[model samples]
Structure formats: C-alpha cells, structure tokens
Target: MSGIFLKQADFFETNGILFETGGFFLKQAEFFLKQAEFFMKQSDFSEESIVKK
Candidate 1:
C-alpha cells in the first residue's frame, strides 16, 4: 500500500516540475513576441516617415 502511494506521489511531483518548466518557457515566448512586435511597429513608423519626406 505504501509503495503504491509513493508511486502516485512521485508521478504528481514529476508532472508539477514539467508544468513549471512549461510555464517558464511560455512566459519567455510571450516576452519575445512582444519584443518582435515592438520592433516591427518601429520599423513601420520609420518607413512611413521616410516616404513622406
């Protein structure tokens, strides 16, 4: 009985670690996406300014 309980606890612990890792990666991806968008908008603004001149 104890062995079974230990196995279940181990499984949950592993899953928790995996979820934390996934969450970290997700945050990093969002940060990069926002950065890319900011750069794109800046480039667009410069292009428009040059065209007007």
Candidate 2:
C-alpha cells in the first residue's frame, strides 16, 4: 500500500512539473497537457480502486 501511494505521489509531482513547464511552451504545450492528463487519470483510477477495497 505504501509503495502504491508513493508511486502515485511521484506521478502527481512529475505531472505538476510538466504542467508548470507547459506554460512556457505555448504552442507545443499540448504534450505536457497530455502527460498531466494521463497522470491525473491514473491517480484517479488508483484512488477509486483503493476506495473500492
């Protein structure tokens, strides 16, 4: 459980960095947007599974 939580936290942290950096890229920021969206979805999925169990 701790391992999963840590992994999720890391993903969220990376996503935050990508999102912040994306601000400077303007036209090419879509890549970071996609990355952030993917991580966010994964985080939500993890939370939902934890809740279910």
Candidate 3:
C-alpha cells in the first residue's frame, strides 16, 4: 500500500515536470517565430526600398 502511494507520488512529480517543460518549449518556439517574422518584414522593406532607388 505504501509502495503504491510512493509510485503514484513519483508519477505525479514526473507529470508536473513534463508539463512545465512542454510549456517552456512552446514559449520558446513562439519567441523564435516572432523573431523570424520581424526579420522577414525588415528584409522585405529593404528590398522594396532598393527597388524604388
């Protein structure tokens, strides 16, 4: 009975860490996507400016 309880507790702790890690990864991916989008826009604007010149 005590062993079962210990196993359950370990599972819960591991699940919490998994959830936290997933959230961190999602946030990091979003940050990178936004950064890429910003650079793309900047590049497009520069290209247009050069074409105008």
lDDT per residue, candidate 1, 1-53, as tens digits?
23443444455556556777755555555555555566667778888999999
Question: Over all chains combined, what TM-score does candidate 3 have?
Answer: 0.61
lDDT of each: 0.59, 0.59, 0.59
Candidate 2 structure quality by residue, lDDT tens digits, 1-53: 34444455555556657787634444334454555577778878999999999
- TM-score, one value per model: 0.61, 0.49, 0.61
lDDT of model 1 at position 18: 76
lDDT measured at residue 3 in model 2 versus the true structure, 0 to 100: 44
lDDT assessment of candidate 3: 0.59
Question: Model 2 segments beyond 4 Å from truth?
Answer: 1-27
lDDT of candidate 1? 0.59
The residue-level lDDT of candidate 1 at 47 comes to 88
